[model samples]
Target: MTKVKIASTTDVSSDKVLKTSANGKSVLVAKVGDNYCAIANKCPHFGLPLAKGKFENGVITCPFHGSKFEICTGKNVEWVDSFVGIPLPAIAQKMIAMGKSPTDVANFAVTQEGTDLFIDS
Candidate 1:
């Protein structure tokens, strides 16, 4: 695997996420406590950019469909439960999901060197 420098330590905080590219692949970098985490920047639900989503407590909520994912592990916490930040009914959510099952985003290994952070892509 090749290590690609994605961001600097100052570029991300615990409450914020940085959207960058790793070897031409969209990557989301977040600082969780003292550790750094990196995941695919695209939402698995609709291929939407996760950079515009909300990040809190090591989880990211997709803005378009409200799919929640764990940034560190890229695990799907909730899937397609809302639209444009508004909660949707179960029936409506199912319809909006369009038979697509919940999927986890891709995660990459992050290595920190001084103020710079690199991801194994």
Candidate 2:
């Protein structure tokens, strides 16, 4: 695995996310308590930058489509709900999806050395 240095632990607070790149892939690094997590910065649903999304608890909600994902695991918690904060009906969601389905975002392994943070890409 290629260990790419993303940022220093001090650079990312528990409430903030640090955006970086590794192996030509945009990555988002965030700290949860004493552990650190690395995941794709782009939302899988619409390829929107997740840095502009909301991060709460352990989930990040896409700003464009409202798709929710688990930060540490990159698991798809919820599919597209609406654009921005507008609520979408079930019919609208189905129409928007057509035949597509929500997929999990890519997650990278994170490691810390001293105060520096590295992501395995």
lDDT of 1 by residue, 12-116 (tens): 889989989988999999989889999998999889999989999999999999999999999999999999999999999999999999999999889989999
Clashes of 2: 0
Per-prediction TM-score, please?
0.96, 0.93
Model 1: residue 21 alpha-carbon error in angstroms = 0.8
With candidate 2 superimposed using the best TM-score fit, by how many Å does residue 83's alpha carbon deviate from the native? 0.9
Instruction: Report RMSD (Å) for each prediction in the order shown.
Output: 0.8, 1.2
Q: Among these predicted structures, which one has the highest lDDT?
A: 1
Cand. 1 Cα-lDDT: 0.93
Per-candidate count of clashing residue pairs (backbone under 3 Å)? 0, 0
Total clashes for model 1: 0
**lDDT of all predictions, in order shown?**
0.93, 0.85
